[model samples]
Target: MKHEIRFIINGESRSLTVLSQQTLLEVLREDLGLTSPKHGCSTGECGACSVLLNGEVVNSCMVLAAEVDGADILTVEGLATDDELHPLQKSFIDHHGVQCGYCASGMLISAKALLNRTSRPHEEEIREALVGNLCRCGAYADIIKSIQVASRARR
Candidate 1:
């Protein structure tokens, strides 16, 4: 069954017809052309499909598109403006947190969620927040450093 849904994405209002069985990741990547949310593990074990749903990080692959009607969703693409990048993006670049690009989107989203809530999260809290996200390149150290850098820079 197809259902019509309205939601806010990247500060923009979007209305789309989504199938009941379709996941948010599917609707985002296929229908909306938002490729920042990757599909790594459909079972939600991998956080490659992470996105901010109402300012909280969630696995898009695990969320049903029809269920999120009228909800606010934010992909990695929504993080930056036309002229400047988000602090996390700059921090990621500065700290060499991104590698292979497969996990970068999800990792970035998770970090964004953390920063939004905690502003300056402890290292352990950072680790706990990102535990679901996996970096194939083993860039955990750099990613952690990137979060720390973003927090420090923001303050």
Candidate 2:
């Protein structure tokens, strides 16, 4: 059955008709054309489809589109404003944290969720927050450095 859902995405309100079985990741990428959330391991173990639902990090692949009705969603593409990138994005670039770029979006979103709640997180906390995200290129050192750099920038 198709159900109509209203949700806020990237600070914009939107209404979508989605199938009951469709995951939020599918709706966001295929239906809504928001492709920043990569389709990695669809099983939700990879965290490639991470997004913010009501300001909390979630695995979109594990969430149903119907479950997010009236919720606020934030994807990687929404991180920037105008032509400027988010501080985390800039820090990632400056720190050379992105390797293959496949995990970059999820990593950034996860980091944003952490930084949103805690301005200064310890290295262990940062690592714990990113436990679900998998970077095949082994750029964790740089990724952590990027988060630390962004934290300093925000101070």
Candidate 3:
């Protein structure tokens, strides 16, 4: 069965037909061609498929595409605007937060969400925000630093 749904994606309004069981990750990668949200673990354990669903970080793989009607979604692809990288993106690059790059998108989205709530989050808060994301390359230090720098810059 297919259902037509409308939602805002990356600041743009979008409408599409989705299957009841199709995960939002599938709709974004397969149908919409948005690939920043990586496919790591199909389970919600890995935050590799993270996205901002209505401004809250969530695992896209765990969300039903048909359930997003009238929702606003933001992927890592939406982080940049007009050829300029977001502060987190720049901080990540400068701080070497990304190594294998598999978990970068999710980490960035989580950091963005955290920074959205608290611009100058403490180290503990940054760590807590990224607890859901796992970096295989052991880049947690750099990732935490990146978020910290970006958070400070947001002030």
Counted clashes in each candidate structure = 0, 0, 0
- lDDT for predicted candidate 3 compared with the true structure: 0.94
TM-scores, one per candidate: 0.98, 0.98, 0.98
Candidate-wise lDDT, in order: 0.93, 0.95, 0.94
Checking candidate 3 for backbone clashes, the offending pairs are none
RMSD to native for every prediction?
A: 0.7, 0.7, 0.7
TM-score between model 2 and native: 0.98
Cα deviation of 47 in candidate 3 (Å)?
0.2
- lDDT for each residue of candidate 1 in 16-55, tens digit (9 for 90 to 100): 9999999999999999999999989788888999999999
- Can you give the lDDT of residue 105 in candidate 1? 96
**Model 3: how far residue 126 lies from native, Å:** 0.4
Candidate 3's residue-wise lDDT over 79-104, tens digit each?
A: 99988999999999999999999999
